[model samples]
Target: MEQKQPDVVDIFAVEERPGAVVFALAVCLGALVLLAQMDEQTKWLKGAALLVQPRFWPGLCLAGFAFFALCHFISTWTRHRKSRQYSFLPPDELANWARPTEYALYFMAYVFLVPQLGYLPTTLLALPALVFRLGYRSPSKLMASMLVGLCTVVVFKTLLQVRIPGGRWYEFLPDGLRNLLILYF
Candidate 1:
């Protein structure tokens, strides 16, 4: 007679990805730093109930955040300790994280231009230009982007009656057409 053992697998284990450890460490450190600054950032008023104090909830939340982040960092570190080494700051992952910042700056530029160039003209120019910048070389795609931008302006301004100011350049146009465009284009 022979006895056999069944194979067992750890269901809770996760595959580590590149840069995960660094991200976890960063989050944990950030939480700890914020938690340390809680006293300076918030006040504890005398005679105020603990529940209603301005600092109470924030302190509690930051404490919990720090605790959980520390736990995650410990777990990640332990999991990866025996595995193959990875770069502390992988360039590809850092670049991926920063990529959204470019789009955010673009949005800020668009916001600034809306006041200078009017809503319709800005939308018309921005949409196609953004499409082109995103590498849509086809004429049909560019036209579609312009159409979408135009429809959005019409819907928000004309149909919904949103309050957006006329562009600086609008005053240069003939008075009647300028007024018309300013009011509902």
Candidate 2:
């Protein structure tokens, strides 16, 4: 009787991500170039002490990460070129990612809206919508989400003095409560 050989699967970089790796590398290079070209005499940089300039740490860290990503990209490209593997997940797989991609867009929109609507109002609006989207349709759950939003507002804004993006929305609160919010937040 002959012994059977096990099958092996190999993943190649170019086959794996197609254009995504190149796009990421280009974005990284562009960001590094932008950072390099930034004026050093900006007000924030001018005001900061040496070694503590506003851009120093972030620039250094981002440059380091970008360098590492560049190295990885080159290594992957070379390895993939030499590889015999042909099958890989394709960019067309994005069609299968509609729900998650939409959720990510929703999250980004939420971030943008927070400052405009203010924290409490944003949270109060977003939490219920998120819960509903996540398939929790109970009235009690929505109400609980609303209650949690109020509690979060009270704890962060009233008690802990966190300056959660305030807008003209706070003006609608009754005077005593509004005064407290003005004092703490």
Alpha-carbon local distance difference test for all models: 0.90, 0.69
List clashing residue pairs in candidate 2: none
**Total clashing pairs for each candidate:** 0, 0
Model 2, runs deviating above 4 Å: 1-20, 27-69, 82-89, 92-118, 172-174, 181-185
lDDT of 1 at 12: 54
Show pairs that collide, candidate 1: none
Model 1 — TM-score against the truth?
Answer: 0.82
lDDT of 1 by residue, 69-161 (tens): 999998888877867566667789888899999889989999999989999999999999999999999999999999999999999998998
Among all candidates shown, the one with the greatest lDDT: 1
Q: In model 2, which range of ten residues has the least summed lDDT?
A: 7-16
Give the Cα error of residue 13 in candidate 1, in Å. 8.6
Worst 10 residues of 1 by lDDT: 4-13
- The residue-by-residue lDDT of candidate 2 on 1-185, one tens digit each, is 98755545433223545544555566678766766665553335556686787767776776787787678767756655667243233445445545488789888987888767767778889989998988999999999999997898788887887766565566888999776645544
